[model samples]
Structure formats: structure tokens, C-alpha cells
Target: MDADAAPRRVRADAERSTARILEAAEAVLAEDPTAPLERIADAAGLARATVHRRFSSRAALLDALAAQLAQRYVQGLAEARVDTAPPVDAMLRMTETAFALKLAHRFAVQLTASMTPEVQGGLDRLFARLREAGAITAPDPTWGRRVYLALLHEVNDLPADSPMLDGDDLAARAGLLVGTVLRALGGVWPPAR
Candidate 1:
């Protein structure tokens, strides 16, 4: 093997290990926010010393996890294609995507409440479109935005006594949350059935 190739391989391995640690951290923390670093290391198949070497401390780990979640949230917004979808559809899509991630990484999402400007702008555009399409009827734009944020928070704020939802249960709850928000905005619910 070439000498340069050896360093490249080591770096690649390190990146993989770091990704594993972050993924494990999210999963373990999802189940228990106060899980120990040793447990996180074990979940990642790494030694506790290795986890410490990588993160230094629990606070640093949380910081890294928060940053990771924020970045993932931004990426999920892009993937949801809010810019092109009709405003109402986009809102539902984005809400579902956000709720899924927020559910999977509840602690990390709690730690970081800031959104990137691009996401904020996209959301603003969606709100305007919703108003224009007569899907929402708030007198002030800010009120509409506030209502949307509140609904999003409500959906993400799962009850402490709630058990982990399966795929079907999660989809049902997300649909209910979306439907409720739409109803609040004067959109019809139950589709006139």
C-alpha cells in the first residue's frame, strides 16, 4: 500500500467512527436523555476512552449533537422541496419531516431552537402562499407564522408517559397534527365526508 493511501484510509475510518458515535448518541439519547457516555460508546462499538477522546465531555457531546441535528434539519428542509411544492402541501411535508427528526433526536432538537435563514425564508414564503391561496386567514402575517410555530411545537412535545410509537402510530399522529393545524387556519377538516 502507498504511504499516502494509509493516511487517507485512517482518516476515512475516523470519519466513519465519528458518524457512528453521533448516530448512536442520537438513538441512545432519544431513549434516555441522560444516558451515560459509556452507554453511548458501547452503542457505537467504541471504548469509553475513545468516546472521551472524540468528545472530551458530555457537554461537548451534546453540543456536537445539537449542531448535527441543526444541520440535518436544514438538509431535511431542502429534501422536502418547500420551494416548489404548493404552500399547503409544502407545509405538511415540512412538518412531517421536521416532526420525524425531532422525534428521533428529541434532546438535540431541544438544545438548538434556531433555524437557518434559508429555512426561515422558505417558511415565510410558504406562509404567504397559504394566505394567498385562502388556506389560512390570519389578519396579520406574524400571527399566522406564530400559529404555525406553535402547532409545530405542540406536535413535537410528546407526552412524557407516552410509549414509543410504531410506524403506523407515528404516521397517524403526524396526520392528526397536520390536520389540526390546517383546521386552525380555516382549512376544512375530514374532507366533507
Candidate 2:
């Protein structure tokens, strides 16, 4: 260690710049996946060159973001404490968590349109658990994938200028979708009195 050398200032600015860029990109993509890179850069208060330096290109940035989101969603599921709740409620909470806390609502919704099957690798286990718990039905090996896409799009019809979705809306729609799919697939929910 060379104590005699002047202490180097921390590179806080570079870290902040990169974080800003990613945050802006995520926000824009949530609202409009096709938003331009230059628009994201402007939102981040950085030059397009700076954004490119960090993300390299649009596709690279989008892929990395999706991969990052998948990992985060899985981690949230693993750490979720849903012991003994109504099976339907537990499943609903998990879906809402993915949308609200993960800021992955757009990722969750648009995945079908993009048809990126790989994200299923991270999510499949959670879907399996939901099915085993009787929150959903295992109509086919890939039935959860179909239900997930369907449930998300059902809510996607919300007006473009609606307020940010919250836990309540997430859970309500999730319950309806999962419940319907379960019955449709020949599974059952606790009967109404």
C-alpha cells in the first residue's frame, strides 16, 4: 500500500450515470418496449454515446434487463413467506409481487408478444408450485405458460394512462385468472357456500 500517494477520489459519478441509464431504460420499456434508445438516454440525463458505452446496443440492453428481471423474480419467490395462506391468495400474491415489487409488470406482460421462451426457465418452478398447491391446473406440461400469458394480457387492456398498478389490482386479477384457468382445466377451488 502506497500511503504517500494522494488518495484517489471515488468514481461515484460513473456509478450514478450507469444506474440512471438503467433506471430510465427500465421505466421506458415498461410503458413502451419499442421506445428509442435516444429517448432513454435523454430521460437518463446522459448522451446516447454514454448509454451505448454502458449497454452497448438496444438488444444487448433489453436482453440483459430481461435476464436480470427473471433472476430477481425468482429470488422474490424463493424468499416469499406465504405459509398456509389460501392457495389462491398465495398464488395471487406471487403474481402481484412480480408485477409491483419487481417493476416487472411490463416484462411480465410483453413476454408473450415477444415470445421469449427462455424466461420460463426461471419461472417454471414457481408455476409448478402454484399448480401443486392447487392454485392453478396442470392441464399440460406447458399449461402454466399459456395461463401466464393469458392472465397478463387480460389486465393489459387497462387504459394507457392508468395509474401504476398496485398490489390489490394485481392480486384481484391474478385470483380471477388463476381461478378461471383452474376450473377450465378441470381443477377445483373450495366451493362457494
Top candidate on TM-score is: 1
Instruction: Record all residue pairs in model 2 with backbone atoms less than 3 Å apart, i.e. clashing.
Output: none
Per-residue lDDT of model 1, residues 1-114, tens digit only:
787998999899888888889999988988899899999999999999888888989998888887787777678667766667766667777777877877677667767444
lDDT of 2 by residue, 1-193 (tens): 5764434323566668777877788888787878999999999989999988888888777766666566555555554533445445555666666556433445433442233444454345555655676555574536675776566566545543454333446555555555665676556654242
Single out the weakest 10-residue window by summed lDDT for candidate 2: 107-116
TM-scores for the candidates: 0.75, 0.66
The pairs that clash in candidate 1 are none
